[model samples]
Target: MQIRLAGGRIAAEVHGSGEPLLLFHSLLADRSSFDRITGQLAESFQVIVPDLPGFGASEAVTGGLEPIADRMAEAVRDLKGSHRPIVLGNGFGAFVALQMVIRHPGLVSRLVLADCGACFSEQGREAFRTMAAVSSAKGLSALSETAMRRLFAPDFQAAHPELMQERLAAFLRTDPAVFRAACEALAGLDLRPDLTKVDVPVLVLVGEQDEATPPAMSRELAAGLPDARLMILPGCAHVPQLQAPEHFLEATLTFLTNDDTGRDSERVQAVA
Candidate 1:
């Protein structure tokens, strides 16, 4: 489904029933990135997955993360009324989710941040700048290999050649300008100081082998947030949901359904 928000059209996929649960995909990725775990999540909550503006079928919108968050909040209100739904965001989307909570407090009931951190390290920022420059100069094809390396662990990439090619094709199809824009947006992101402001329960999940954000960043995020717990998925990389769907679902569902004070008690079993 597509909804007119602000000045642009936002494309989204809505499924199942019950309380609303919004899923936000990563940079260079569309809503289909969450296809692996959508069915399981939908069984218990209404799943609303949308393509970030400039990424998929969603029309591009102006401004950075703040304006995007505002538009997303508006879309949520329009779709579910006064309902404050649970939000799950990965990679760039996680940054947007954090922006949403900070910009519009009480907009999200609970938060699940996956493969994201409070802020990028200096080296990470440099990498993003390089990505933007490369994409702008050489186009999306030039970014395919680097993007895959940053997204999946070496073992997974080696084992799943078919899936790797599939993702590469998708990445190649993305508009280089949009990819560069996203890289620039990420280069400017810094949410460390604002972490203390987040009062809602949060679940921070990261792949143990994640190279993009890294586990150390996730640790800082968990420590900074007022009420947050960290869970590391073994042998997984940037996109745990894609690389380890069962473990991802178990960790996320357990956290979302748990009534406990969002502590470490609800552990997501590490896959062997």
Candidate 2:
């Protein structure tokens, strides 16, 4: 489950069989956030989920963005062999996925950008800056509860205390320094200029209740892509896969299968 990269070891888990699909977790999350959806996805595709550098069991990165992108692309390449694979990322993970498409176009056959937005703008930069500052001053524990609440609708959280606690625990498991680094990376990211360079088919999924990135931002990202589709999931928050597993799975499977309509009969009904 661990591969030695140039500067560190990348902890990645592989499951199922068939076409390869790579998963990237959100800013404060690791591969385990997708645990509820992975089993179902693995039934049809080979799901490769990695705990990004500085998060979970993955080693920290000594270099910056360029090296980070190269390392992630390399990880994907190692997982998929010669054939380009579908790359999917949620939240911060989506940002990295977009970078992969732009920085290593030939390595990705398709993209699934969930709960992320256009980072090529002042507002996007500001969000990252805010996260960086907060992480540096307050640490991951201070932001854990708020982060969880922000990822879901008001009623959703009230109904899912156990789920929120589980996720918050994961987010808090990382070292404070590592969390701060992630925030700084987010603040420094702005890939608007490179969006046009991405030629692969893309699917952008947004949560209707997502205030962090908002739905409009996701729309803008979809508009910038060459061949892309946008789907807004109702009654969901920042982490739709965790907030509404069935809808998230439908949107994801539809995108991966090349269904332009964003509709799939098969749905993951329950969370793991």
Candidate 3:
């Protein structure tokens, strides 16, 4: 259900009842991308999965990720209950979450960021630019193969034909304009200078084989942020949760439930 209190710019489904846990999906995927793990997470959290702006039932926003983050903040405010939300973002959603906490200090209690970083290297930036140009000219279908490659390792794709097909369908459903805009936003984005402003506990996870954002980017993201922990999911690519759901859950749950470490848990440079 859309948050009636928030005027419904963001389309979301509510699950269970407890501390709010917002799940933000990747650019190559939609809200349904999280379907595999939402139920188990719901057992412990009131999981609210939203279709980020320009995806699914959600309304599109302008000005790239900034406004999208702003819109997401509104969703947080509307859905927040007794506790501040613990946000879990994947891929592009991770980028939006980074900006949201940066732009709005003390908003979420903590963050679980997967497959994202503060900035992309030249080669990475070029990938986005190339994708944007191709998708804008020939439409999203033209880049289906490339998008799948980024999301999963070639071996994984070859092994999981049905899942690959499903992911491809989801990728094609992305609006061409929105897809292009996000690609452009990510290509030029550099949040390294402002990383200090995040000021919240963040658990950063990247796939060992991620080609889109790469592990190096995740390393930089963890290093730049004030308090963060990094984990590399074995045998996974861009979307670690999708590729290795058990590993993803174990890391995320441990981080979310273990608060005894205090400031140390948030240390960005630590890797396990």
Best by lDDT: 3
By lDDT, is 2 or 3 better? 3
Q: Write the per-residue lDDT of candidate 2 for residues 1-272, one digit (tens) a residue.
A: 44443334777788887788888988766688898899999999888888777777677775555666677887876663656788889987888788767888788888889888656356656765676677787776767666776677779988988987887887788777766666676667667678889877878888888877788788778777767777889888888888788889987886677545332322212222
Candidate order, TM-score descending: 3, 1, 2
Candidate 3 local lDDT, 1-272, one digit each (tens): 54532467888888888899999999999988888888889899998999899888889999988999999999899875779999999999999999999999978999999999999999989999999999878888899899999999999999999999999999999999999999999999999999989877888889989998888898888877778888888788998778878778888888889975243433443232
Off by over 4 Å in 1: 1-8, 263-272
Could you say which candidate leads in TM-score? 3
lDDT of prediction 1: 0.83
| Weakest lDDT window of 10 consecutive positions for candidate 2 | 263-272
Model 3 worst lDDT window (10 residues): 263-272
For all candidates, the clash counts are 0, 0, 4
For model 2, the superposed segments whose C-alpha errors exceed 4 Å read 1-8, 80-82, 120-124, 259-272
| Backbone clash pairs in model 3 (N, Cα, C under 3 Å; residues 3+ apart or in different chains), count | 4
In Å, residue 246's CA in model 3 sits off its true spot by: 0.8
Better of 2 and 3 by TM-score: 3
Per-residue error for 136 in candidate 2, Å, reads: 2.4
Candidate 3 Cα RMSD (Å): 2.1
Writing each residue's lDDT as its tens digit, candidate 1 over 1-272 gives 44444344677888888888999888856678899999999899989898777767777666777777777877666664456889999998898898889878877889999989888999999999999998878877887889999889777999999989877777777777777777887888898989888869999999999899998898888888888888899999888899989999989998888898455534444544
